[model samples]
Target: KTTDILVQAQICAALNRHVIDVTTPNVGLQDWSNSAEYYQQSPCNHYAKFWDQQGISVDQLAYGFPYDDVFEYSSSVHTPSPSRVVVSFGPYTDGGGNDNDEDITGMGGNLSVQFTDSPAGEGFANLIDNDAATKYLTFNSSAWVQFQANNAYSLSSYSITSANDAPQRDPLNWNLQGSNDGVNWTALDVRSGVDFPSRQQKQTFQVAANSAFTYFRFNLTNNSGSILQLAEIELFGEGSSSGFSQTIQAENYSSMSGVQLENGAGAEADQNVGYIDTNDWMAFNSINIPNSGNYTVSYRVASEGSGGELSLDVNGGANVLGYRTVPGTGGWYNWTTVSHTIYIEAGTYNFGIFAQTGGWNLDSWTISLASGASAQSAATAFNSENSMLEIAEISLSPNPAKSQLQIDFTAEHANLTLLNAHGRLMESTSNVPSGSLLSISHLKKGLYFLQVEIDGKVTVKHFIKE
Candidate 1:
């Protein structure tokens, strides 16, 4: 927030019910840890402000309740009904309540502009990416900027901020337009001979849309000189900011053009391709949740070698939804799905997928309401594939096996069966052939279990399907 602030909360089961302990410098899983040298920066510096609202004195509310003190995090909301549900979502742009100044346009679509040659990072991409430190600049005195709304929206108003330096580069004349397509535009607002005397100074304008529009255009012409620039742009409307469903296709992500995209089956995935890149990311903008609760995110992915990790970042910020490790499937074509639950405030947000280390392939991802889901579903989300095994001695060749697998065992003829992460049978082979190589190039990437029945001895081995 504005000033440096962090607090830790501790509630003792043994302590009398009314006593609460508080401390400084946040220490939590998503926030800063006790060992972390860096401080945590969240949207709210004082989640414990609720206590102050309740008239609890500072000395009495020692250490501060912190987030965990009052808010409970879980995949399901049925445990305790949420008092307030998120209602509306605006465009995930600056001046928009959802993004909160974090740039995220690099993850996906929704932005297009005329110029990008002013500064290395200051271009059309940076304009909507959410960082106020970076700005959009164009060499041409006249340029056009556009924003696409994946969903319909009712207009309210918007604002623009000037670059922190050089006031002469600001737009002197501009026109705002609304349209269903970028080709055809209708003027909504226009300004002539405008000026921002102070750098980074923001000027807002109010407007009303007669009907829902999916496209917004900002035409800037006749700037102070031979260049046009802006630090940020924001839009607001009556649009519901949260509680909506969105599907992100792996091949459709917005990242550096270097990321490789390959063909895929578009059955569960929206796009007919998958993507792979290191440190590159894909983003989904204007994700609206109907209510305040935990959302179960399901990802369909595959990897060939030792898999890597994937982290979910909201609005290009450090707010990690969760992290999941990708398991190796039998081949690059083999695909399987994994899931995790994350808590999100009911509102509009730009959700992004960052490749922590890379070498992971994604097919698609989906987010669904988890309030009605079973508790078991939430628990299983945390368990990794091949983490549990009862029989350890049996040697399985090619641990992160690809294409084929070899199982060596010393026992009488036994029955062999392969199961998926969900404990569902995928492949079965009987009549033990010790050290035999089995063709398993058809399995998807994930955790699989192998069960063997020999004499009276039963052995179960959990293996990675990579």
Candidate 2:
């Protein structure tokens, strides 16, 4: 069985990996290290009671002492608490005699409690427990326990513990407010209810909108005669911004024509000349080129036409380069080698291959740097069928000549033909130029191919008529 292998030329670019080093400015490294170390060990529990104290008011306490001294105070107050402590304040007056009548109006009945030396005070442990004592104190009607507001905050939940042993007097009333600049205020929520003696109850409020407020306050309107206690208060909301990063991969193949790898599949070859139709080509993976430089492209070709040629253009775009042609060797399955070095910039470039004349087969095309600094010469040995052709030595003079042409061949008998751009035979000479010159100054100014046939082997050389 015989098979025709259509090899499409593949052009690609690649970049090597690079390493970069970054350095920081020299400064007081000691200070920077100390600050970082200190911050790492700082207590995050500090924010737990961030809103517990603000302005001149105290909202809540971690631990408190009871009004009655019947219970013994534990020496180990540093223990963790299952719940937070609360403090309630109201007016207490002493009786006294009225000046106009004999009635006692100004009695020494007014009483008040100060937050002093109790585990429930400002300097208590980071956390409190349920077994902790609840602190309650009497105050004048003009007196109020200040609760700190965390800017504008939303309350998720709150718990209140009352003294069951004490008798209740006035109903306990509370109101929530937000303040900007810690002065102007807006009401958020309010509630009034009878106090539970020596019992715990929880209240929760949901915020409508997320806002920025510096001050929040929980005002106590009326406190039941019995001292009040609060177990815990919690506020929740979104606080920080989120970030995202994305990566993009770009490829450019606009400079390519006849042969191209579309959609990252394989290589495609165009057999017909003129405008190339890319619909019949194979796609391949994209190449990544780092910087612009010079590269040598090589490919295998097998053609059966007496004078068929293929044109390959590499790095074709605003700045085009790498233009060359591979001539037909008149045998199928005969591999021919052609190469060209082109300077390309650092970018994705497109390459194209077109059949200048008749159909041809292409295979194993690769672009890489030449072995040495000089331009890479054409291949001298190619595999054809089961044998390799040791290319015969042939010479052409005045390669960029203005008019004359010369050639030297080793074969005793040979046939030579000068063909123009349209594949039309311009001139033919036989058994001559074995080592002599052929004059033809009348030839038009353009590109032409010199075909020399010796035995069954053919050699094609390109010349420019300046």
Candidate 3:
């Protein structure tokens, strides 16, 4: 079986043909096992051995992914930015304990204060100082610690660490508040009857909010005793303008038909979704799109079976936002990444990855909007070379062109071909004159690469189809 496989591969290489059905296991690199295995490693690590023997570069290789699998499925994004915080502490006032000044740098050199005196070593600043030996004790029920973020943000989660000392002094209940200004506050998160059994242990609480907030207040209501104390507080979130990536785990599909969640597969993000066949589909919904801009969506895919392709569409639309081809890696556990950049307006859209073809396993995928990459910059990669590709030399009028687009070239004639954002050919015309009109009304309303091939040299220009 191995000799025949090598022979076939050699013949295909000589004829400039590639095989999508053959992989490393077919040649016996790693023993094939039907049992559970890691699925997160790049699948093509063993391809170098074959290329080395044949003395051929891997870049020249191409693939024809089987798109026979078609299944039904269902999917948000938020960005971030830098943040500024103004600190303030105190009202009732009390610092007399063992030594509170030792924790001045605890809150990034921010101010700290408390109400009433600590018995001896306990101080308010010690509450967040991460020391069981040190504690912040407050007798008043109304004492609170607050932070005001200069650049407003929304938190997805928060955590608090308990002091290692007395459990009776640990904070039991608190209300998280957000405010534009300090005075008027809205409840963002609230905790009641929460307890910590072990000292110095941290517990996390999940909360949801989309509104930008400048001020956050943690109101300590009640504790195990009449006094309250805490070790640390942590807020996990981002500023409104910070661009971020959202990863969708393949196994977390809302509803998947003809697929299985392969567990203990060495996936860093839990199990992967595999067992794909024709008509298999997965679905994700309510993905957050925090801003409007060009975003790159990347997929981690693997397969030992025939290579395949997938299409990304929004809201169950027939129009594909992006399409990618998956080439075979050596084994089912081998993995590879495919990505596409496209422009999408700011809004929550149901993102779906449909198997135009099956035979591939997906680990996870992510979407990220790059900073400074706007709509115009998102118009695919295009260059006309010479002065022809220059803005003043060549004129493409009515940008975001609705109907017919006119291209006036300094030269007499140039070859023109239209390509999608992925650089795949959509339309081609050879030897079009200097001044010509092209009908792009039928094209999808997104970025397209227009290549002007002249004298066997290519110059490309990007334009939007309205």
Kindly indicate the candidate among 1 and 2 with the higher lDDT: 1
Clashing residue pair totals per candidate (backbone < 3 A): 23, 46, 32
Per-residue C-alpha lDDT of model 3 across residues 346-417, encoded as one tens digit per residue: 578887788888888888989986432322332433333334544335667666575888888777767565
lDDT score for candidate 3 against the true structure:
0.58
Ranking by TM-score: 3, 1, 2
Worst 10 residues of 2 by lDDT: 9-18
Ten residues in a row with the worst lDDT in model 3? 68-77
What TM-score, to 2 decimals, does candidate 3 have?
A: 0.35
Give the higher-TM-score candidate: 2 or 3: 3
**Cα-based lDDT at residue 315, candidate 2:** 41
Q: lDDT for model 1, please.
A: 0.57
Please name the candidate that would achieve the greatest TM-score relative to the true structure. 3
In model 3, what lDDT does residue 439 have? 87
TM-scores for the candidates: 0.34, 0.23, 0.35
